[model samples]
Target chain A: MTDLTAAGRGVRRRGPRTRWGRLRERGYPYALLSPPALLVLGLIAYPVVLVVEMSLRDGRAMNISAIGQEPWSISNYVDVLTDGDTYHSLWITALYTVISTFLSLLIGLGTALLLSRDMPARRLLRTLILVPWAVPGVVASVVFLFMLDGSYGVVNWILRSVGLTEHGPQWYFDPSTALAAVIAPTVWKGFPFFTLILLAALQAIPDELYEAARVDGASAAARFRYITWPAIRGTTVLGIILTGLWTFHTFDLIYPLTGGGPDGATETWAIRIYTEAFSFFHPGSASALGILSVVLALVVVASVFPIMRKQFF
Target chain B: MNLDRRQFLHRAGLGTLAVAGAGALGACGGGDTSSDGTMTLDFPTWQGDEAGVKTWWRQAIASFQQTHPKVTIKLQQVPFATYTDTLTSRFSAGKAPDIVHLPTTTFGSFAAQGWLANLDDRLKGTDILGNWTKVQKTMMWDGHNVGLLVLGYAPVLYYNEKLLKDAGVAVPTTFPELIAAAAKLTSGGVYGYGATTTSHPGTYSEATWMVYGAGGGWSAGEKLRFTDPAVVKAMDDYRTLARYSPKGVPSEQKRTLFFDGKIAMMIEGPFVYAGLDKAAASVKSHVKLAKAPFVQQPGYPSNSIHVSTQASKKKADMAWEFIKSLTTPQTQASYAQLYGVPSPRRGAVTQAMIDKRPELGLFQSVTDSAVDATPDNKDIVTNFSEVQKLIMDACVRLQTSSTPTATVMADLQNKVNGAIK
Candidate 1:
């Protein structure tokens, strides 16, 4: 009989085949993705687990031997919660994140709207707007430090020339201004990210909406409020959440500029974590503080996520 | 259908596990020791970043290698700002180098942590102990020798003589006079007095000199003495002088300002001499050195060398040998002559060396009364940097706001007490 005999019928219907073939057929996509998943577990998840485990132990500079050797307890978390400075730092971090994120989004949205229009040197301007974001955080901090220096900064020179005051304010040294000084650079560096994202979102908005709003006798503000705002709400919320998380953990920007100084006025939770671990050599406490910081950041992101989901998905 | 999906998921999960298992196995490779019966002793120091200082170190290392032919001394250069962080990370990873260039402020903490090898038994009846000053002896932790003094220098007041002369002001010999001179000298863009008032560790060191000069310190016999009347007075005096200085200037900026004639006076160590020598002719011509005006003899902040616990026993001995070699009179003298810094070894500053740089003589003269600024309480003292930050924060408040002195001092006292407790 031929291979296509009635009983055989096209190689006997191929039924499950070999076990290895079945496995490949079922798991090919997951096999292709396993390397990255493994990397994420190794690098990110492993360290996170270590940090959380460390946060549960009693550790300090004097008792390095006791680290992870002692019984695990919530004593570190208890101490962190009871400490007044911890709350102060947490408050500072929250204020910093909120103000910086708000200012960044506002400035980014304004710039995005401006640049989205038909303007002179539009492409060149769009490219140049990214310079701040492209600049390293430390470099941006140093640049702002020189500009706002009390003695011979260009900012001071400009203020003096304009007769703003007799002596320029100590932007970095005064408690009242230190946070603002650090925030200025942080916002400057951060807004560009917002601008790029929001600009894309604004461009995605169809031109017909604006034309329709204009035909209905809407003013610029009215059009922005009705058409543009609705179109970009989801992107704006996402941008703020992303930027807020980053600004909440902004150590490099603040450390180089004010070092969270002028009596710890700028000492946010992130700075506290650094000082605890590096300066005090107490990784346990630092880890505890770090965990708290992450939880707070996650809470902020979670609260914003649902709104984003509802607006978009 | 559900059974097939479950099997597929189980296999995919196994795929992830297999990848992770392979990675863990790959990273589990062992650390191998050197073959051919040669031992490598790694020595990490911040001085290697300095061109001149690095030259001196390379010479020292070469000489050390010549004597210890079987041991190779590897020099690891780290930046000063991140040196502590780097050292701690190395220690945590169990890969610390054999020799560590320890800062005085951190020696006690490292020793307490048992990261450093005790040199007391190792160096018994040795001349290294006799060579160090009383201040250097404080490097011992719990009566065990933890660090050997490597380089020592007392901070002194560096001034622009031209600016003082033009202002018709004499060199201030007392704290009040210094403040008055600063006020007089602070006309135009030039500040009368300059010290780093930022949160840099050097800021704490410089400010503490003023406190020690005022007969105040962080502790007296294990008691928290930060709120002493003397400390308060010193803080007020600093605040006054700070008014005449540009606010929020860093250490390097202060040095540059002094060199450029924008700062009439500043507090700095012997390192300032080198910086002055590098300045333009006008700035260099205007430079002057004076003993730091203090009621008590101010402590000389010094750096020490320690053998790491992570080193093997033989390598530790070699590391100790290398540290001892650094403290020799000959090496100390050579270092002083080349780098213009004072040596911790007594009598290491030769007459010829002093004649070469007069500032060396001034720094040497002040060494006799140099005290350790570290608090006597070992428990709280390990957190010296935190204390320094607290004091610095209070100083900032005193300068930036019209806070009552008593209120500020009380707050500082509370903060310090809380930290130590």
Candidate 2:
């Protein structure tokens, strides 16, 4: 990852050096590139390969050095797939990932539209939207949990006050709604990134496109569908991909809120991996599961990549 | 930031390390932790208590330095939050703490991973485990001593005397009496009962107390008979208490309601006593640290349950020495004096703790009868997470609508049993 970032930095450092004509300009490229490369190789590549190796191997994490004595088995992968619980958790995770991503994008797009438009206090609104990210996941979970509290939350208060609800919602406690409670915070913490990315893309679009639509006498909705969306669809795909990745590994929101509870109503695969590996100390199995998650994520990216790439135009 | 060829190379290399190793380096304190003499200990405690713990350790280590002084210990307390993730990275990197604090439930897996030091020789030679209970003995994993009771035994209830007083009640002797007291103390706004049910100490703290208190024994039931009536009764009682809870009974959040005077009564382990005293001056005056009330059954005596602090066996010798010294009457008494925690050792919870904090008298009686939260089984504790999830699910369903409580209860029981097998 740093390699990619460093590649970007190399251009910045060298391009400016030649323009400025400094003595060390020639060396700047190597100077800028070498440190990060060597460090990444030493620190990242070594450990990651070790992890990838362990993922393929059949032993537990703590017993890594005991490789020869311990039997290497394919059972870990078998366990990840055949374990009734794993299958359940994967489905739950997939459901969580899909629902949370969709909801977050919708919420984020709405907010982006509102904030990117000529609204009074747009500065404050944009800043406020970003505040959820600033709130720690656990804290955000607590606050959201409190707000939608079945017995004592503010959401119920507002709802009942307006006669929308007689009592507050039992967000996490109710299985029917518990999954939603976990997803809400993901949308909250993460919508801002989506908004920022999409809005930035919107801003970068040439204003003349909208003007051209107006000159062609297109309806406001038509112009939005034609010019506004087509221009920013690429950024939206990227934003959703990023958010999807974030939600895929999301543990805190689900953990604190529901703990994947109500008899597995909200137990995402991440929570399952935690309970199995960390809580249960099933590392070999857990690592195998972890590898599965990475594969699942890659499959998602690979599936989405072609669509996103084509949309880039 | 101009760099000569070599310097630029070095800087670039370091930068790549910073990025490529973000998770690893971030997992470590900052960057490379391969320093020859320097060691990083991943001490996981409660999430928000890192700073206070660090500060306390700095003083404690400084004092310990008065002894041999040659060794430098960097006591890094991972933030109470993110503790699991922080440790997972360390474990993955093979960079776990030289010393660690393992919870009883988590010890099974950690030991299975060979994350724990075999403290067998350490415990066999030392008198530290003397004050420890045989019931707590089940916490022993793979027949090797993984961790020991370092700080808390378990938390019981700390009630607001003023709130209980205004409600015109003494701490109840039985579960029914306890319920009445809590119910009366509870208004529409003020919770009758307070519990720290959050995952860390509160979940274990109160869950252990309640399950044991209800006399739903943790020993294996007849083969495959996991859910007994007692277990159901215990779950029912917990669900009842959850109804009267302040702030929806988060494992850790109810302390706020208790401290804020919104809760009439709440159960906490010894861990929060010091912090509570700081929050409420009236609590010091009127805060009643009592054992959890017994579950009421006809012709049955009120049974108060014992709560254990999460245990650890990370620094085998040092941890045991600390536990042994702490449980020693003198050390326990000294610690009780320094921090308001009662010495968990029955003998060590002397008359002095009661004299200094008279509220401890209630705890003393409770402590005498306090028992272990059973099944210190690795499978059980690992499954405890599943249990909590199942119970919480039932809790959600029961609270959501007027569903048949039995359906919810049965579903939960089945889920727990399924996880265990």
Candidate 3:
């Protein structure tokens, strides 16, 4: 009991750590993460700041070098907000995104369910489902353009063989069908993403859960409702959010297919931004529209956050 | 030989940083200037890969290099669809090519941005001022000659002799007769007219020809005339003509249809003659060019060559020499012969050229009296791209909708007015 009370038997008391050592221990993880954080700031934040700055300048003729010297104003925002085309584009974007997302999710879920069962060439079929996604957007647009061509498309040929009608409708040029025609390729390209995600989530479900449901005398629909739906609800919501965002910002498909033609029937926000920037050479207006699009996307996310938090968080 | 994990990471990091630094330095470098005093002038053109045009360029470049041994012209090919946008991006980035070749429609925009060097001083002792075509006058921007006009021609009416003969139609010389002939030729997967009904940049030019033919125009100085009675009539006529043409086809596709023997008639520039060499065998011999069936001939400066402001003074002088070489009488004659289009210089089309391609006579006569179809008003010309969009949108509406021509034109007038302001 000689020094047990004071120094704990043969152990000496250590002095307090130095200030530099304490700070280093606290900041070591952040230092390791600083490179990626700086990259994100440079890549993402800088462009956003530049766009916001350009939106406040007069950008007629769109000389990028002269943008900094131009006088700053809110006229770009005023012009974008006051124009009727902006609202029309917003409406078109909403319709295209919602319909395309819903259809993609439905098709993806169906395909995933079909593939989850044992069948011949199941692996091959699953791999083949990704072909549409692998094909470049412009290439896919070109293919669909040929298939849905008014005068000589294979779809029209099939329709004629079945006696649907003579000289099938102008799918891309007709205002009534142009939006739907654009959405077809979009769904074909987008559904594979959901299929990949949902298939993983589907495979993770235990066989015991389905077997117990079967023994409990549940119907197939009931078993799906209790086990499959609950298991994949969170992933489905995530897929919807992601697909919605992508569809809202899609430009390559619609631009090459119609260039926002047929009297602006398929002109969405992204197309409008392009026409304003590259076509009209009005970078100020384009930047303003881009900022508004970001705001619109955030609003949509905010609206869906409550439901997502209830299920996912 | 025994590298620890930390040492390996240290070496890898240094290597990555070195590579990235080298890439950044490489990106900052512009046109090449070698130690032997040899300089490379970057020249980009949409016509660099065209069948006959590329031949002309090769010969021209070879001749220029023979004279200036230490100077090399680096010719780059850019597709016409994205040419202007590419140039604009380059100019904005302060990396403009030493030699700037642009569609005449976009010349004003580049000039307005000060990307093109003023060429009046360089032209003081040159024959370009007096001997070039009248359309070359369009090269003046804000009292400065910033470029040289390369090609100018009246739009030509191209028709398939086989289709017209099979339909028992004559080569029409008037708008009404043309429509009747088109109606006769249109049947069973074949079209009578081959207008660009899609939302294309060419749609404005196609519709503008109709407007000018109908004695209307987009603007007169600062005055907007989209709602003029003649314009309305022209737009209505265009809609009626669209019925006989294939729907939703762009200029290239329409040209393809004509080459495939599926289209009977189309109106295009004399450049279409070059494409006939690649047409289907059955259609190639049957295609012929005539004066466009319009009351007035519509023409504009097609393309031009200029020295960029971004080039050094020495390089710019070299660029000017290359451009001047292209405009020489001998080179001009060769260009007209090889390219099958009317050259900008006077007396460039020799009798031999006309004898080789009989269409040259008609091309010259029409080009001699062709009225400029582009907007002449300062504000309108400054905002031509926006005005072009409005016109294209109106054309698409007229083609795809049943709305009255008056209503569509009125909407366009309002939109164009707002755009110019």
- The best candidate by TM-score is 3
Angstrom error of the Cα, residue A33, model 1: value is 5.2
Mind sharing the TM-score for model 1?
0.91
lDDT of 3 by residue, B1-421 (tens): 9999679869978998999999998888744567688998888999988878899998999999999999889999999978888987888778899989999888877777788999999999888889999888788899989999999888989999988888889999998888888888899889999999777877888898888866778778768888888888888888888889998787888898999999999999888778887899989999988888899998767899999988888889999999999989999998888888888899999887898889988888899888877777877777778788778888888887788899999999888888888
Candidate 3: which stretches are off by over 4 Å?
A1-16, A24-33, A311-313, B1-32
Clashing pairs in 3: none
* Candidate that beats the other on DockQ, 2 or 3, i.e. the better one: 3
Candidate that would win on lDDT = 3
Better of 1 and 3 by lDDT: 3
Better of 1 and 2 by lDDT: 1
Cα lDDT of all candidates, in order? 0.81, 0.63, 0.87
Instruction: Evaluate model 2 with DockQ and give the value.
Output: 0.25
List RMSD in Å for every model shown: 4.8, 9.2, 2.8
- Candidate 3, A209-239: lDDT as tens digits: 9999899999999999989999998899989
Q: Given the true complex, what DockQ would model 1 score?
A: 0.45
Candidate 2 lDDT tens digits, B144-253 = 56565444354466788887777788887667777778878888577888754333334444544666677665445333223567766765676677667743456555
Recovered fraction of real interface contacts per model:
0.64, 0.36, 0.50
Ranking by TM-score: 3, 1, 2
Residues A199-253, model 1: lDDT tens digits: 9999999999888888899999899888888888888887977898888889989
